[model samples]
Every structure is written in structure tokens, then in C-alpha cells.
Target: MRSLLVTGGAGFIGANFVRLWARERPADRITVLDALTYAGNRANLANVKAELVVGDIRDEALVDQLLASREVDTIVHFAAESHVDRSISGPDAFVETNVVGTHALLKAARRAWLGDGARRPHRFHHISTDEVYGTLGPEDPPFTETTPYAPNSPYSASKAASDHLVRAYHHTFGLETTTSNCSNNYGPFQFPEKLIPLFLLNALEGRPLPIYGDGMQVRDWLHVEDHCRGIMAVIDRGRPGETYNIGGGAELPNLVVIDTLCRAIDDAFAADPSLTRRFPDAPAARGLPTASLKTFVADRPGHDRRYAIDCSKARDELGYAPRHDFASGFAQTVAWYLANEPWWRAIRDGSYRAAA
Candidate 1:
């Protein structure tokens, strides 16, 4: 935890992690390696000060250069092609970045950390998603670390492959590594593609809030801050070769989340009345509630019915538990978006679909 090379550090969770680290670990030297794709916005990291290296994770020369030059003791690998909808549309980029790019990172880290007998004690922490366990039946228990990998979509399959590579590096090559499969994360600096921010911004602008299928697809919604804390717990105290499931303990279907978010926006809007002028087109400003914008669309192919994580290992072993309850976190999230309209507007207004 002395010097860190954080890949995808300009993206959602990575940016949040980098910002938190800069504040909490001011003594640590943190460098960000990001391709600055549509998802990886430099503005996400604008408020914080960190060394930013603009490059792709698959660039072996660049990865190796940073590893050697920085003497990085830890690598928090968050670089991946993560949007499920995009993966459904174009799986090639997902395979290339998630699988091939991860391999490049593992190879570079292994050579630099373990090869030539330098034997520098190091850590490679992979951030993954619970979707790798596939969808669960209504009655099935939450996925645990031992849950079989049953990825349902191209996105999850690619991530599953990367998870395996990290484990293989630890077992075969003896690279010190840890991984955490987290649930849905919603908080500040999130690009407006995923559900929360997308819905919030869309509803704010009077656009249709598209719900896949019946809007009943269940997700375990973990606040981004909580997810970041869980990752830090794993990086600080996790045993090598172990996988931890990080969850926020807030499980609900998509429709319920939308209703909650809409109401939160309503309250936030009432408090900050000027939002009527900011997102002036919002239906709520015209006496129509934000939730009226809901419109169900064809579901994603192979949409997971439900996802839950059994993170008891993280709780019992790593002393981890979510601090913000769903209500508080959700309220704060809506409020943050209300306050930071310009930040997301810059992203939402453009063709921000370029892959990271």
C-alpha cells in the first residue's frame, strides 16, 4: 500500500477509489493508468490530485514501463469493458479488453514482481462483478466465493475469464493476488449509462426511463463508497489467492430502485428548487412526477433474473460491513447528482459510449 498503480482509475469505481485514497492516504504515491475512453472521464478525477498516465491496460510496453519506473507495490486492476448492454451489442471489445487486456496486466505484473528473483512483495487486486455467478433462482441463496462461475452474458463471461487468470497467477506463478466480486454500485462520478445515473439524468431531462423486461430483474445494490471500502479491506488484510464477495446488503428489483430514485430526486428537487431551471425540462417541474417517465423495453438478452452476494467472509474475516443504509446512501446519491449537474451533463450530452 505504499505506491499504487491503479488501472482504469479515471472510471467510476476506480475514480472514486483514487479520490478516496488521495484523501485518506496522502502519504501514498498513487498513479492512474487509464485510456480515457468515454467511460473513463478525466473530470471524474479532476477534483483530486494524482499522477495520471494515459494508456491502455493491454499495452504491455506501457504497463511494464509504469511497473518498473514507479516501483509500484500494489496494482488495483479495475480496467475492464463492464457495461452488459454494450457487451450484448459488441462482444469483441469485451473479449479484447477484459480477457486479453487482463492477461497483459498479469504477465507484466508477474514478470516485474516475481521474475529475476527480485521477489518484491506485491499485490494485484482485481475488482469483479457478481454477475460471473450468473442469475440465481428466486429461492437460491446468494452467491459465495465458492459459487461456480456461470456467466450468462458476454460481459460476465469475459470477467469470469479474467478472475480465473488472477487465481491462476497466484497458484501457478505464485503472484500475490486477491479479488472481490461486488454487486451493483451507484454513487458519485458514475457515467450516465448504468441504471441509477442514467435514470436520474434521463428523468431529469424528461426522457423515457427504459426498464429492461418487467423491471423485475433483481440486483444487490451496493453504494459505491461501501464497495470502495470493501475493496480496501481486501487489499489491506485479505489473504492471497482468496476471493471475497462485497455486497451492500440492499437487494431489490429494478422497478423499486427506480421508484426510490425518482422520489429521492423529487425531494432533492424540492430542496434545490433551482433544479427546475437546471434540468428545466424535467416533468416534475410541470407538476408531473418523475416516475411518470418510466417505459419498459425489451430486456437484455440473457438478462440475469437475480443476483445476491454472500459476503459473510468479508464481514467475519475482514471486519467489513456497509456503513450507509440503503435509504441514506440513495438519498445522498440523488443529492450529489443534483448538485453536480455540470459534471454529468458534460458526459451525458456527448457520444460518451466510447469504450474504456
Candidate 2:
């Protein structure tokens, strides 16, 4: 069985990837390294069977130890300061983690895997964002792997730097590497700070669902599961030193997503009367449309106008296709949040961090 070390495996998309990998490759030994940051909750992996090492990725010594001790053949680097707002407010942390932390991992991998006279068989798959390609105009085509990066936000800029580092390691050290720049992802175990989860939770508590600007900004939404699947395909079949773009094929404006989410919540309450009791404060609980809670606010600085990914490369090369449509995916997301109130509630009230 191949041993794999997943960095940031306790975070939202990372946790989802870990769970998927465990289920799909039962024989593979999985090790997770996370700093247990605010977004990286250990509880996110409560049901998944894997070794969890609570440490920062910037710790090069620790990474080298894990690489040598575990005899890890694959490294899925997912750790990053991902939130745009957080990066805007504090770019230092983003640079330190995304750029510096990634470099540390690369160095450790190079020392452990390539230090010997003979080259080793290993893969370093870096997870990145389409935001690195910057905003698109209304009539612009979706971003491709060949698109020249024009990162606007600090978070995306940091990710762009890390991507370049991964590429550099491949060309300079002959380290086998690949990168996947994915569109927006939404699914279970997501931190509530993101748009979908944050709005969902806010609506449940009678709080206004804040929409930035005109909410016309468009994005291609990829289901986290599909993204994990795409990653697996890349690890298994993709050529070394190449990049793939994974997208859900669900490109819609932010307003449309919010409207759909609101309608989904309303439908959930209507279908299950018990939801009214559970989330009594919700507009749906009072027989009012969940859309009643929408409150448009001022847009954040440097907000990207649009982001779309052209996944034709992945589709043709790796037979990768997103299985979840926005409708079914959004419905499931709403249902997940409803069924796991305690999980998100802990996060919302700051109890999860305290308990951690």
C-alpha cells in the first residue's frame, strides 16, 4: 500500500479529501499534518480513520521527520490561509503560510526523497485556486491551465507564489509534481466563514444574509467530493509537471446561489415540520420566504468580478467530470447543515475552538 501524507487535512476541502481517500483506497496508509488553525478543526475528521499530527507546515524538521518515518510516497499539499477577507486584513499570515510553509514542505521533501543518489518515485500535488488567474470580464472565457496568472488579492497572490514554487521544484530538482487549480468549492464540514455556510447559518438564526455589492459576481462552483475525485484522477493518471483545472460546471452569480440556498431552506422547512422547531428563528420556520433575510451590503475591496474554469483538459486527459449539479449539491448542503446543527453551532459560538 502506498503511504500518503496530506497537509492541512483537517480543514474543509482537505478533510473531505481525506475521507474520500480513506473510503476509496482502504489499503493506503494515510497521515494528516495540520496546525489546528481556526479553520482546521480536528472534529472534521472524527469519522475518518487516519493518523493526525497536529503541527504547523512551516515546521520543516517535523515535515522531514514525517516524510522519512512514514516512508510517504505521495504528498497532497492543501494547507493554506485560504480566506480572501482574512488575507486582505492580514497578508503576513498568508505569505508566511502559503509561500513560506509550502517552501518548507518542498525543501523537506527534496531532502528526504531526493537526497539519495537515485531519484525516488513520489508525487507532490499542490492544491490551488482559480483566483490566482484573477477576475474575468462578463464576456471573458473561462480560465484554463495556460492562462497567465494575474492574482489580485493577497491570498491568491500567495497561492500563485506557492504554485510557482511547486513548479520550480519539479524543473529544478526533478521532483514529480502536479497542481490543480479549482473553482469555488462547497460541501459538508466547510467552515461557516465561507459564503454558503455563513449565509445558511445566519438565516437559521434570523440574522440577515449579507450579500456583497450587487451580488452579480459569478463563480464556477465545484462540489468538494468531485474535487477530491479529480485530485485522485490526477494522482493516478496525470502526467508529471502538468496542471489541471477542476470545475463543477455550475457557473452562476452570487445572487442566484443565495436565492437557491434560501429556497432550499424554505423547502426543507416545508417538507419537514420538525425543522421549524429546530430552527425556530428562521424565516422558513415562520412560513416566510428565506429570501426575506437577504441584506445587500457594501462590497469588499479588490473583490473579483468573476471566476470560471475550463475543465476540458481534465475531462479529455483524465476522464474527470463533476457529478454533482448545483441543485442537488445545494440541497444536500442545506440538509447537512440542518442535520448537523451541533457541529456548526459549535463553530458559530466559538465553542469548537475553545474545546479544541
Top model number, lDDT: 2
Kindly report which residue stretches of model 2 are placed more than 4 angstroms away from their true locations once superposed.
Answer: none
For candidate 1, lDDT tens digit of each residue in 1-356?
Answer: 48999999999999999998889998899999999887888778886868999999999999999999998989999999999999999999999999999999999999999989879989999999999999999999999999999999999999999999999999999999999999999999888899999999898889999999999989999999899999999999999999999999998999999999888777767777787787778988876788889898998789999999899999999999999888899888888888886787678766443432
lDDT of 2 by residue, 1-356 (tens): 88999999999999999999999889999999999889989889997889999999999989999998999999999999999999989999999999999999999989878897767789999999999999999999999999999999999999999999999999999889999999999999999899999999988899999899999999999999999999999999999999999999999999999999888888888899998988899998999999999999999999999999999999999999999998888888888988898899888888888745
Taking all chains together, the TM-score of candidate 1 against the true structure is 0.97
Model 2, position 250: C-alpha lDDT score:
96
Checking candidate 1 for backbone clashes, the offending pairs are none
The global C-alpha lDDT for each of the candidates, from Candidate 1 onward, is: 0.91, 0.94
* Residue-pair clashes per candidate: 0, 0
